[model samples]
Target: MELRVGTLNLASGRDGGGRSVDAAGLRAALADVDADVLAVQEVDVGQPRSHGVDQPAEVAAALGASDWRFAAAVTGTPDPFRSWTPVDPPVLRASWETLTGPHYGIALVSRLPVRRWSVLPLGAGRAKLPLQAPDPRTGETRWWWFPDEPRLAIAAELEHATVVSTHLSFAPHTALRQLTRLRRWCARLPGPVVLAGDLNLVGPVPARVFGAPRLVSEPSYPAPGPRVQFDHLLGRVAASRPEVRRLTIGDHRLVTVSVHPG
Candidate 1:
């Protein structure tokens, strides 16, 4: 079977005007990727900012996936950083309030059954450098935003393979440490692995440090006319080569890939 994987920005819930994310536009964008499993970035679980839409669940329902899981990079309330927290998961008839209830950071959506799951934390502290993009005030170069904690890596074990997704820090040094943590995690897995998300590497750091291939040749941030490649899909393919794509719809782009089993 041809397994499709997708990584989308989801605009972190709105456009420049701070409007709600377009549900129809989001559904259309998801349909365009049509991946078997999807890795989403900037998803708003229970924020009023997103108009009470549990982004991952809504998208999964729209796509009719048999299974889905979310790992929140940030939560709606204060920060303590626990191993796991309980919240009402999203469902078909789940209300906007229910749908938009508190959510885990990052997430994994799949058509196949997920046998197991775990969340890995990458420690903080590293240099963040802003990129030069087309913006009015800054006119180009902007400072990179570093989260309180390093980026997260969420993994799931399935009947056939293991897949992971995370948003890497924009800081080069921080990103390198994050990738190193990811490598250590990958070393302990017992099956084929596919890692995807916003890599934030514009240069050769990905190849040099991660030992994974860049699925596409384009930038994922700055929406319209992206000049830097921040998102990525990578991993070991066993006896097969990974198939990755950089999909652009309107002002957003998604990076998706598939790893064939040996």
Candidate 2:
């Protein structure tokens, strides 16, 4: 059976303006594509900035997925320096307590029944990245030093394939290191594997590092007029090369891929 997979950076479910996340609009947009497995980044859980929305749950419900998992990369607000608290889970578990503040992370939602799941921590003892922050006085974005936030790869074993979802660091070196570790880890898993996420790198960087062919190529950032193809889907499964399409859902463009297993 052909499986439809997708990946998107939700930007905390906010539109381009970062004003608010319209759950209805998101649901409607997702319902239009109806992918079997969806991987999303920048999802929020009980976050004030996004109005304490359980973004994964909302999206899963919207898509009518049977199973969904969220691995928290940061435990507090979005600001990495001010209030962000990194969470390091020993194992990938489904349950998460309602945190006092906001929780930011990646999520995977699957319509296919999940056989098992695992979470790999890739943010240990890494140096912080300089983020562009808005200047309070001039309303301009400036580079500011912030702690290297935690990153995780959530692997879900479905009936036919093992799908891994991850969001890597913006820093090139850190992302490359994490990609290496991820390749090593996925090697131990059984069956064919499909790796999907926002790698934060351009061109064939991930394909070369992971030794997997990119299933599709499409620009998925800065929704209005995307110029970079940051989001990707790469895998070892023998299938037709997927064609990625962009769906405008609020502020960000949701990228979807369709794979037909041979």
lDDT of 2 by residue, 78-194 (tens): 443544567856334363434455577899989889999889999843576666644322324468776666789999898878889998887888889999999999998866888
The candidate scoring highest on TM-score is 2
The alpha-carbon deviation from the true structure for residue 183 of candidate 2, after best TM-score superposition, in angstroms, is 0.4
Q: Candidate 1's error at 189, in angstroms?
A: 1.2
Model 2 TM-score (2 dp): 0.86
User: Which residue pairs show backbone clashes in model 1?
Assistant: 46-100, 71-104, 71-105, 71-106, 72-104, 72-105, 73-105, 127-171, 128-171, 219-228
RMSD of each: 6.5, 3.5
Candidate 2 least-lDDT 10 residues: 133-142
Can you give the lDDT of residue 5 in candidate 2? 87
